[model samples]
Target: MAQLERFAETRTPASRVDDVVARMRALGDDWPPRDGVAVFNRVYLSVTEEVARRIHLGAFPDAHAAITLDVRFAERYLRAVDAAADGHRPPACWRPLFQYRRHPGVRPLQFALAGINAHIGHDLALALVDSCRTLGCEPADLEDEFDRVGDVLVSLEERIREELMPGPDLLQIGDPLTHLAGAWSLERARDGAWASARTLWALRDLPGVAQEFGERLDGAVGLVGRILLTPLPD
Candidate 1:
């Protein structure tokens, strides 16, 4: 049976999400160093962003795909989403495309979202590299992810340009105003998810999480935290 089918027999999306979060916390607790903690944190955030992006893009038939079938592929999608979400210069790309009618008010938010998206992608790329080193998975394939994200962003930007500047070459859509509105709708969702991921990560503590993952390690998370947690023995 497919992986989703096997998972469906035992648990729902809510349960699966909980399990994943718990696993993240445990993994964090097990690995204590700064690099290890960073890796664990990025993996969790990357998976979350990937799931959100897939859902937004209709890559799946429905919401269930977010929690079910796509669970295993989150890391791959994370890389894809991050790559496309970064390297966008709205003024250069969107301005010409929109005939220089750039809305200054929304530009800041757009840039902010782009920045957040890049950070997410960068973290995921780093984590993938670390995982390849430590876990012996197939090579991280960071280039592929970067290319995928760049392609999507460019495509979407072209689509937006066409919508805004409907010359003889650029055909009309449902309605120029409505189309821009709708395009921004997807942008908002993507931006919101990026923001949420940042907030969640700030609130979480990775060392505690690692301990949960590697419960067997003596003093596990504490061992790493001790030096930081206490002053040198005088």
Candidate 2:
């Protein structure tokens, strides 16, 4: 947390996106490839890099909104990482991943998906509100940016499944892991995130209600993450 805070303190607003990429890259280098968090980090790092590329090419209708949303979105996940590292409990949505990070029976795909579930289901809505506050715009104003980022995540989820899915011989429909993976949908998660963002935005005037809603959102997302991470047989 201190390290990231210091880095943020020195960074200019224009460099914030780059700062996020650098932090994710550093985390990747530090954690073993098979570590559960590392698995998610690799997946997220790839998505972030792709989004950065698209932003550079003017792919978004509103690049500034996209960048603000992207950076704010990434910060939520990074803060969870920092919290766990500092011996503090991460958000409910993140607890499952951190708890099962090194479990031997959890496949890389499950680790990856669980992390994605947490990030998209819980972190994204809050991040949207954060971005809106920072940009002085409503969630509706950032809808295009939100959808663009969600598109990147949806595409990446497909790739992650392909890369981490077991071979066909072992991935029978009867397999528990197959069933588990089938139950969660990145596209659905993305849609839910947008809805959640709107809901949070509406509740913004009631800070206590918003906070409670956010907490419940975190717990519900965490429950799904825990299920996604259910251990499978070797």
Candidate 3:
């Protein structure tokens, strides 16, 4: 808990992408290797670093929009971590990872996937809305940035599986982990997030409906995240 407090302190204002990357790195350093949140943080940190590098190299078509969207997207995850550390309930989409962060039966792959599920399925859409509001633009204007970020995540998903998957000899076809992993697709989640963002943006004028819609998305994503974190034998 004390360690979490220290890590939470590392979160600076998310005005700069480097600050967000640095804070996530601090979290990766503070958390033990097996801790579920730590595992997710490691994966997220890598994505952030790559995104930042691309932004630096002018790889994104609109670097400003890309940087804004990336930072906003990351802030949502960091806020959830801070909320958990402070003993508060995070967004519904994040509850499962926080609840199962240290369960012995949960594999590193499960942790990584659960985190990705929460972030991509739930946070990404809202982050799009956030970026739009901040940049005084619409979701359509940010679609390119969104796609670029999604591409980075999709590419990373393969590597994450390769690195976190159990040895092939032990991971037989009958393994529950194999079945569980096959059940969720990052690409599908990314598409859903984009749709959700568009819907949410359209509902911006209808605060009541928008709030309800966001809540439903959060709960639905949380359900998927919980399923992804299902424990299996070592």
Predicted structure with the largest lDDT when compared to the true one: 2
- Give per-residue CA lDDT, model 2, range 1-234, as digits (tens): 456557664676548888888899999999999999999999999999999999989899788789888888998999999989999999999999999999999999999999999999999999999989988989999988998999998877777888999877767779988899889999999899999999999998999998999999999999999999998999
lDDT of model number 1: 0.36
TM-score ranking from best candidate downward = 2, 3, 1
Best by TM-score: 2
Score each candidate by Cα lDDT: 0.36, 0.91, 0.90
lDDT value for candidate 2?
Answer: 0.91
- For model 3, where is the 10-residue window of minimal lDDT? 1-10
RMSD (CA, Å), each prediction? 19.4, 1.3, 3.8
The C-alpha TM-scores of every prediction are 0.26, 0.96, 0.93
Candidate 3 clash pair list: none
Off by over 4 Å in 2: 1-14
Ranked by lDDT, the better of candidates 1 and 2 is 2
User: What is candidate 2's CA lDDT for residue 43?
Assistant: 92
- How much is the lDDT of residue 218 in candidate 2? 95
* Candidate 3 Cα deviation (angstroms), residue 21: 0.7
